[model samples]
Target: MKWYKKWLLIIVAIFVMIPLFIGIIQHNKKLPSHISFEGPTYKTDELEFLYDLTYQKNEERVLEQQLLGTALEIINEAENFLVVDMFLYNDDYDRDKGEYPNSAQKITNALVEKRKDNPTMSITVLTDAVNTLYGSTNNPYFETLEDNNINVLITNVKPLRDSNPIYSSIWRPYLQWWQPSQEGFLPNAFNPDGRKGSIGSYLDLINFKANHRKIILNESRAMLTSANLTHDGSSYHSNIGFVVQGDILKDIYLSEQAVANMTGYTLPDVTFKSSNETNGELEIQLVTEGKIKKALLGALAEADEQSTIKIGVFYISDRQIVKGIKEAAKRGANVQMILDPNKDAFGIEKNGIPNRQVAAELVPNKNIEVRFYDTNGEQFHSKFVIVTDEDETTLIGGSANFTRRNLADYNLESNLVINMPKTHVLTKEINDYFDRMWNNDDGQFTVEFEKYEDQTLWKKAFYRLQEFTGLSTF
Candidate 1:
């Protein structure tokens, strides 16, 4: 080959290896220490944290009695307007058909019912087009609203229509790339479900994430929830939801509205109906960290002043988070962790980070308290943080995680810092559950949920080689 071609191949090889090298190096770095959050604080109390824990527990938190659904109810009853952005939305009863019952249907039904009762009320449902479970009934939940003239906007929507991932990613990519002028590619890429895409628009479905999940319901209520509006997420599987009551709710809702407009979808020119901007003595701020590592790390650094730190998350691998907790513990903060040890939560033992060796090293810290729970049958997926101030005010939950992606802006995540006058009973309940599991010798000791009892000889051999190779990044 010519020198230029040889150099070109070398460049590509280096580029490919660079990402792998970075990933491995970061993975091998020592975890950070615990620290308290003493930075600027949000003293708003109206916002509270709610999680729908996996069914693994006999009882942790349920949808019927939880604050998340009630908050949605309040938004539906809004006299001003209701706005919701979610990946999953239900127009039918999913759980009755052997699906798990969650928040989507009950909330959607409530909105539909509310719209009927109050014809003049304005409501908008904005969803990621990819998540619409359009079926034989035609997304009745959305249709019912649309037929009634309720505005609905579907997002990250390509023109293509197909239920198969292979069809969308593989076959579609090849055909569209090779036949740029093909009629099907453009139509299929932009006109998913035949409801979107201009007649002549041309584009393929790329962008793996176009707005994973977001919901801003009305001016009075807003949520940065991890649960999609699906049966498994809401009723069947474990999930987490956070509701905002003060000005932040309105601020977030409007911001999401702006995102909707910028992305080429239209919605009513909506603004916040009046809400109390002055939320009592608690300091509050809306923290949205998505891949801007430095910005999110700063937020975590500020949160290191609390004496008691309770962190709930779906994925926690942020070096800064580990550092924050460890430092806070060093600073005399009582750092206690309640984590889901089951690999399904973040994948498992050998295949994932909750590796026995890693967890063993992490738990040995004297100042930090770490407790892992079995989430085998259920999914223990909740991401929120509760910190207590000197005066004992409670900081509510949010979307930011102790992960590189959440804080470093690699991925967009939102977290709300609310100062409640007192820690709500619900927060105490969650903390208590953590305590119960942490204190007990075993929730069900027989089963070490986080550990892997089965591993092939090849996998073990590979890991041994990894250990010996000093390939700490692996």
Candidate 2:
């Protein structure tokens, strides 16, 4: 063969083999079954439900968000061990924002102090590599934790299914092997012009999967939330969480240990088992990843003429669940959704895509009501579903967004499925929360679909494309 022709053939072979290699690894990636544990649920008096609505009113910002505060409290009060798996745990906001409240740093400080107080205590923080921009840069906050003898587990994405296969195909064979050089050359993906990343970091940005669970497991209690410890995320975003003190904490610990094991972290021989003792009247189930989708589908299938389903979520792009919801509305179940408009991220403004389009799809059904979560400057970053029947009420909530990447087992997500008596205090409180937001009581929690409805054909196509292809940030 001619020398030039041989070189061209080599390049073509490289392109072809890379994708095949990625496909092989992605197909063979091992993932355990989604953990589900059902135990006695606690009532309102037995457990605390922490919720805060961060908003702007009268030209002033009201940051009532308290999920991070509760997480910090749990860490400070932990006596033996502290395990946290957070999706985002870095200070990566745009510098133009002018130094936001550094929540991640504060949490790190608390952990460091706790270690100092009791040098034998164990602290492990598991977080996504996105905080470090796919290992392109170093996170000072995480480094500080490690400096204090805390164990930091950055999730190994190699075992995760490729969400954006096009990028993963190229990234796997060539760039995946490149060492993450701290010798900065490229601008930081999170905050450009502040800190630079290595070439490998830029390459890894193409793979858009994450360990998105926001869980804090301590000896006495456990919390599952939709809030991140990132400085930018803490102040301006509205979030929600559940803090339970029961046998469920042990279940949470085991589930978190599974995540640690995935990244090759050998947790101490911790004896964690559900005590099987009753905490209160509410019955709880810990559902993760694909199990959550199954529970959601089953609950939607149960909706009937007399049932009402209310959802407030950050994103909703899962087709099976969406279709089930539509079917429920068609069957005379009252269905309502207050979804984020997908309008802003950090300092970037976005056009409403998935939420608006989803709203438009259900608008034609009289039994369905769709509204946009009213926001001042930040996103309504909560993911929850409440279903009420004549006798029983069910609430599913946690860090999982209703999107393909979030539900299809591509991301490490955890949620709680609670079935309680219709008249139970916890049930009443969740119902009241929906009612307050729906009625615009006290603050403007939501606006009618007409306020920000975007049914543009192009956007519908775009949302579907991203949701289907997994080339999205949701």
Q: Highest lDDT among the candidates is held by which one?
A: 2
lDDT of 2 at 242: 89
Q: TM-score of predicted model 2?
A: 0.92
* Model 1 lDDT tens row, 429-466: 55665554455532331233244332455544544454
lDDT of 2 at 77: 90
Which stretch of 10 consecutive residues in model 2 shows the poorest summed lDDT?
A: 33-42
Which portions of model 1 show Cα errors greater than 4 Å?
A: 1-45, 48-68, 90-98, 118-120, 129-148, 157-210, 214-216, 230-234, 266-279, 291-306, 330-332, 345-361, 389-396, 420-430, 440-474
Instruction: Tell me the alpha-carbon RMSD of every candidate.
Output: 9.3, 2.9
lDDT of 2 by residue, 1-474 (tens): 999999999999888987888776774476753333233344433466777786546656666766878888999898878898888887787767445677887888989999999898878999998887777678898889888899999988567677777677777776788877778688776775556788877777768888899998887778898888655544668778988776677668778777787788877755443444555677777888877898899899999999999999989988898899999988889998989988877766778778888888878887999888887557898899898889998889999999988887788889988888899888888888888888877776788999997769998998899988778877
TM-score of each: 0.64, 0.92
Q: Any residue pairs clashing in model 2, and if so which?
A: 41-282
In model 2, what is the error at residue 93, expressed in angstroms?
A: 0.8
lDDT of 1 at 250: 47
